[model samples]
Target chain A: AQSVTQPDIHITVSEGASLELRCNYSYGATPYLFWYVQSPGQGLQLLLKYFSGDTLVQGIKGFEAEFKRSQSSFNLRKPSVHWSDAAEYFCAVGAQDYGQNFVFGPGTRLSVLP
Target chain B: DAMVIQNPRYQVTQFGKPVTLSCSQTLNHNVMYWYQQKSSQAPKLLFHYYDKDFNNEADTPDNFQSRRPNTSFCFLDIRSPGLGDAAMYLCATDQGGGNQPQHFGDGTRLSIL
Candidate 1:
């Protein structure tokens, strides 16, 4: 079985500061990874996904993540955080085949301080 | 825009009462999933419908049932609500294939009293 671990439960950063959220996964093979963001009282929105291509995948809202096979990590990063970027972020891993469900992390809550 | 739609943004039901949540997708994806997300927790998959075939999670309680009459619509039915069942129920849709992104609706917040 595959699982995801997000070490940080909550993080606070100042506006305009660079931010990185760590994500680690345990999968037997190369896994499909994704980043999702959810605001309070809102459903999750996909940030980006990694299948099989460039290790660095760019997502909506100026977010990006790099798939590092050696470390089994796909950390989400943003160059400059905005106040609107405060939300909960989740890291998920999916199998390469069909009919399989994605395993999601517990999620990291981000707070942007001005 | 074509998207997944979940009805009743908020629901309040009494304990032991039966409740049903509806989800419809304009994207017409072949797969629809129901997930339960409690406060400060990740969304846990309850079940999913692939086309018309239903797939329930191994640990999903029997009280939770689902119906998918067609590809575009799915329903999550709880036979008897408990306090533990009070959580946000999210509906998502995805193409029934590898590497496809799942789209989610805003979700229905269920409150069991």
Candidate 2:
């Protein structure tokens, strides 16, 4: 079975500070990794995804994630986070086939200080 | 622009009453899914439709049913609203293929009275 784990439940960071959210997955084969952000009373927005090739992938809103196959980790990072960046982040793992359902992490709540 | 839309951003219903939530997509994706999310919890997949074919999760309750009348619309019906069913219901759509991302709607918050 495939599963995603987000180690941090909640994180507080000051504005303009760097942010990193950790995500780890357990899968038998190479996995499709994704990061999504959700604001209060809103749906999830795709931040970035990794299918194959490049270990590092850039996403919208100046977010980026590096896929480390050996460590089974895909961590999201932002060089400078703004107050608006405060939201819940989820990491999901999916099979290579689209028909397969995705397993999502519990999510990390980000709180940005002004 | 292509997008997924879910109706009734907030709904309040009496316990044991039947309620239906609707979802429509302009993306024309082949797959539409329903997910239930409790406060501060991850979204849980209840069922999905792949081009009119309904697929239910193994643990989904018998009271939960889904209907995809066509490619663009899907409906989730709760036969009896329970207090435990009070949560945010999210609708998502995706083009079925390798590595395709799913688009989500703002979700409908269901409150049982």
Which predicted model would earn the best lDDT? Answer: 1
Pairs of colliding residues, candidate 1: none
TM-score of each: 0.98, 0.98
**Cα shift from native, residue B113, model 2 (Å):** 0.8
DockQ of each: 0.77, 0.74
Q: Which pairs clash inside model 2?
A: none
In model 2, the Cα lDDT at residue A54 comes to: 95
Over 4 Å off, model 1 = none
TM-score of 2: 0.98
